[model samples]
Target chain A: MLITFGAIAIFFAVIIVVLQLSGIKDRDFTDYAVGGRSFGARYQAMSFLNTWYPGAMFTAFGGMAASAGVISFYVLSYSLLTVVLMYLMAKPVWIWGKTFNLRTQPDLLALRFGSRHIRTIAAVVGIISGVPWLVLGMQALGTLFQHMSLGTLSFAEAVMLGVAVIALRQVWTVRMGMRGVVISDMAQGIVAYIIGSAVLIGLIVWMVLARGISFDALDQKMFAIPSVGSAEGPLYLFSLILTGAIGGWCWPYIFVRLFTADGVESLKKSAALAVPLSLIFGVALLIFGMLGSQVPGVSAHPNDVWFIVSKEAGGLWLLGLAGVIVLAASMGHTDGNIQATGAQIANDLVGNYWQLGERQLIVIAKLGMLALTILSSWLACLELPALFSLAVLAYQGIIQLAVPQFLGIFWKRGNKYGAIAGMVVGFVVAVVLELGYPGYLPWAYGLTSGAVALVVNLTIYVAMAYLIPQSQAERRRVEELFDLIEGKRSAAAVSKGVREPA
Target chain B: MSDDGKTNPNNHAAWIIGWFILDAVVALAPPIYWAFDRNRTAILGLPAVVTYFVAVAVFITASIVAAYLAEARSGKAG
Candidate 1:
């Protein structure tokens, strides 16, 4: 069964590789990496879903839900709510991307702040911020492979399998950049959704008729998974949800994606579709969790839920399909995010101080992705409590941008000094709280840091906008950026399901 | 805050509708729970909490109703 599954998976993988590589148009690195910053709704939606929602979260979330009960929905909802936040921020980000021709976050900071110092801080922070996520993704990938192997492979062998595939996949990523990444993502999204939906419907029907189960029965069974042993209050839901949605828009990888869309409306339309797609995919995991609740037949870990479901319910060929789809999902995620962070480091930090060529920039970006992929693969071996924890930790720090960036974009008085201060302060506070207290209970609520970031960012922005005076050039740049965004929007366009950032 | 925090000052009603939807999503927890509990299997004397469970039911009548109202309110007075 395992051999048959692996064969089917390899076959589907080859097809995906051909589809992704067939039309690679990345003549240069920026085009390869950022796709020259022009993504319509379809591409945006495809890439966003594929790239945004991967890692151990997908593999482990179902198990966590099985353990945590109703609270599990919070994790899933937190993931989905980010799209709504993305919808709000996409307008400013796209407008800025178009105006400044910015490809990386550091580029945006440098363009506006005109300070290499600020860009360096932001770039380094981007790399540092992204490390845990990369490692977590690698870990989840390794875990999934091992658990799926069912003792056929050793632990080290499992990790190596994940690493080998990632190493192979980077060959294309190093060449094509975001264009290749998106094409690959679109492929993954299409294939995964089809397979995922088919599996879900099949499971739903099988469980109802064959297994004789319902959602309520499933919920009741799964509810006792996360035992709250006097930790945070149930209100933790409120904080986590608030932080997840609000802080979510600020994530560097996902944030960079907003800038890659074709236009404001395209971005928004993609967002409208993207949110529900994320939710549906999420529901598939939840259902799988419900199936696993109190039932034990396989020796798989949290990350192997998809594989387990496929292997148990269907034939060997379907198991192979599940493996390839999961791997594709992982690759699509790492490609854009790793490369984007690399570009940020090279351009924002190195080039900000000294001019770097497209060739040099591309080389550094490739190296960066290579290093990040390897590092993440290695990190996958460690005992990280759960995928959900790492995901939240990642957002807990970055979400501080809820005030400084997401809200700051529209606010006129939003000055660089205030935003910088708020972000710095909020970033520090969040990390400390998360480290010192850490959130497992309902009370700590994910939003404590989010709220702090919002408050500080707003307070600082308002005060700075009022007290500080921008030089003529800076004010003009701000006005130009805003004006371009305002003049371009049309009411009729929105009615046609064209989502605008505004 | 200019009655609606119109930072960019292009439209009014859309902003309200957006923020309203956002706030409602955050504030309304009990109703969400109620719908899940009732339709999936009504327990005891309590009616469904959400008053509208789009997730349950065969035809998705609840989702349509909710979506229609949201659309109507968000629409401009042409």
Candidate 2:
């Protein structure tokens, strides 16, 4: 127990000390919000990974594999597709972000549609959906702490301690802003994904060869996937993969990764580099979970499979390392959410309403981070069942942003009316269907509520584009934005070149 | 290729769109995955379904690398 706690403590201490030494002071709001838009492929890749897969990857996702079966591999498929989307969107998003000094995802929408109302709507939706996950992230730490204590601490005591540790980590988040978050993501990602993958692979080898826990010995049902004749229907796996691929970037913390890269090329490089890491780590963890189900106590408490197997295999030392990995991943997740949400609050919500100075915006953003940290920590302590359900539904709701975000970038025809209407209706429908059918709609043939709502959302967006045509001026403005993407010479530049020849 | 003797951006875009289509079919298409859903075979001590998806991921990664290289050759990466 002491060794496990000591390992976790050392992990936290190293992260904080490194953050302190690397912290930059006197950064303006832009510098604070997006790390001054200066990071290479490796930093950007790690930051994206840390934000993409929370600590729940170990607990909730691992549990799903242990309990359900191979369906958890949906993460691996969607993650790769998500990276492809990131690569495709890199040029347009990075160019616009750098060109117009866009800081948040909402800022990009507002710039594209020329509407502050759209910005506020996007920002509000982002914050509302993001808060639940932040609370759940804090709760994930509770599980980590409980396991690390080796039965010394009660679940309630562990919950409080986990929340407290995460809340305290917000000090650096609020102080150093995105810079601190990115730097810490590098360290945390290494522990969580790199070392964590190694541990998972090692344990798998030990379990299969030494302990005789091969697939042949396990139940055949663990390998089955839902297919055409299955009860869940054929589209079930398809919907899961599609939702994850499209909705992956809709999370504000994940979308903001676009702004952190140095340029479009760097962002593309990062997307390429992120693929293998996500595949290896995600696959190894799920495989471990699936194999660990054969262990004595794991099937009963599936969520504890990662820790249970670690403790069973190598006893205390490996368990300590596992604890440290989850702790690092969770801390990175919590910090990223806090920083991104804070910047959205200050930049999108408040800054749009009032013209605040840079320093004032920075202060407001920091204050927002502090307030959110406290609120989420308090909510995490409640451990409400309804909140976890909402966090799951939040994924469905967040994907509503995709239509507006992608269309606004690619298709100039999508006006603010369409963007706003589609998102509002899509989010409401997702929530309603999710509440009615918690996970999937049986009536919809295994299609998720999110997918059904997305269909409606896309219909409305396309219809409105033709129904309510943009004014000539707005059309030209949008044309100019697209022109920037194509590298077309502007009228002014063309005239200047001709005149210079004389 | 365009008349300027450079790779046409539209062709590059087409290739990318094609790659994405391939990826979607391989990763999400029910029929494609259903073919491998049987548990009769195991490649690396993993079920056929699991190995199929793992291979799909690698294929997708290679496609992305191809796209990156194409973009670099066309000088459109930046």
Q: What does TM-score give for chain A of every model?
A: 0.86, 0.97
Q: Pick the candidate with the highest lDDT.
A: 2
lDDT of 1 by residue, A82-103 (tens): 6655655655666666655677
Candidate 1 structure, TM-score to reference: 0.81
lDDT of 2 by residue, A271-330 (tens): 877888888898898888888889999889999999999999999999999999998889
| Pairs of residues at least 3 apart in sequence or in different chains that clash in candidate 2 | none
| Model 1 iRMS | 9.5
- What overall lDDT, based on C-alpha atoms, would model 1 receive against the true structure? 0.59
Model-by-model DockQ, in order: 0.12, 0.35
* Ten contiguous residues with the weakest lDDT in model 1 chain A: A493-502
Best by DockQ: 2
| Most accurate candidate by TM-score | 2
Candidate-wise lDDT, in order: 0.59, 0.85
